[model samples]
Target: MDLHLKGKNAVILGGTRGIGRAIAETLAGEGANVAVCARNAGQVAETVEALQSRGVKSTGASVDITDADALKSWIRKAGVELGGIDILVSNAGAMAQGNTPEAWTQNFQLDVLGAVNAFNAAEPFLDKAAKSHGDAAFVIIASVSAAQADRADSYGPVKASLIHFAKGLARENAAKRLRVNVVSPGMVYFEGGIWHMIETNQPEFFKQANSRNPTGRCATPQEIANAAVFLASPASSYTTGVNLIVDGAVSNRVNF
Candidate 1:
């Protein structure tokens, strides 16, 4: 399906690798001009180059999403390069699993404030895009951990807050014609991510994790990206203020 996405512009945060990278590639493949950001300049440049090779307009910047000014500056440049943003994918985040105060603070900063920064920076561009494009969208990459109580990590509360944030934005933006939605993925396997940490440091837990899921396997980044593409595209034109769970039915099962 074409998804009617050609020529649209998008800004993606934390897009150097993992699920964020997947979302960038998927949107670009659908013919959207994409701007991606990460902390590492080299990786950002490389990912931008890769996207460019696919015949999509692509740019990258190194910015800390936790800093509001830095995010605003980067968004301004990206909006200029992409000729105005039509879609904003708030994907930057980290898994802070420690139970200490410091870790809790770090998680909130990245998952909550980082998303806020992205939204604030893109608000004007998103307004412009919706006024012009008529089918503009904003997609927040949340997690199924938001709905679960068993998560031992800091990811749970952060994701839960993100869900609320998306809902609030959707409520406020519906009159403006900019659609807001959330995709909550579960147990995604990406290189050097939580899956790798589990496999290397807690093999037994990894086995149990897989067994608990009805699919008997974790989700791939591409699968999560596919859901993102739908929300970002005109395919989900009426979808707003909803959290689409892409967790292979694990979230639906009753855990005994």
Candidate 2:
């Protein structure tokens, strides 16, 4: 309940909107300092201001996560500015679909490399925080699509790679008290997100998508964020190298 997160600092990628923004706000509300980064300078600024309004020290930067050097630099700077990164959330994704080479490139660069660079840059800060507090975490936002795919696409494979990466990190960093985990969301919908656009332009497909969910609906950004923030919190100290699926049972694959 308490989460014991007060005074901790967190760095979030793509925290300007959607599920990323919700995670930032949730951490801020839990009394954790937050730093977010995204390509939109205006949105980054707005999110920073909004997080600070929640009475937590907050900062943000405009960053293109596809650029490994730039993403790593921002993450390092954010770790310092936040006073040490106790939690790192990789919530950014290209969301590129299809089997085209370009789609694969985009997903690999943004979704895959983005998490790799962020973790590499934040490892030192994360190790330091864990050494001092006995708990530090990296939460990767993946998708249930990673577990099952109906067709060839870049999105699912890239997300699946992240799970593998996080598991390796978790095992290697366990001695450092740095826990790594994944929160895989299914069909999360938010205004201006992909689902919203689909609802507007491809009404029948959107309706069919909703109907596919056993709950007869999709998840909210906040719903996914709740799982992410929980994993990032000290309360889940023993929950490393695990993928928590928050899909309202939309996904049929059993974890067994």
Candidate maximizing TM-score: 2
* Candidate 2 TM-score, C-alpha based: 0.99
RMSD of 1: 2.2
**lDDT, each prediction:** 0.88, 0.94
Q: What tens-digit string does per-residue lDDT give for candidate 1 at 1-256?
A: 6699999999999888888999999988889999999999999999999999999999999998878898889998999999999999888887777667877888898888888878888889989888877778889988888888764667788888989989899989998888899999999998888897898899999999999899999999999999998998988878888898999998874534
lDDT tens digits, residue span 145-166, model 2: 8999789998999999999999
Candidate 1 at residue 34, lDDT?
A: 93
lDDT of 1 at 83: 93
- List the candidate 1 regions with Cα displacement exceeding 4 Å: 151-153, 253-256
Kindly give the stretch of ten consecutive residues in candidate 2 with the minimal lDDT sum: 73-82
Superposed Cα deviation of residue 2, candidate 2 (Å): 0.7
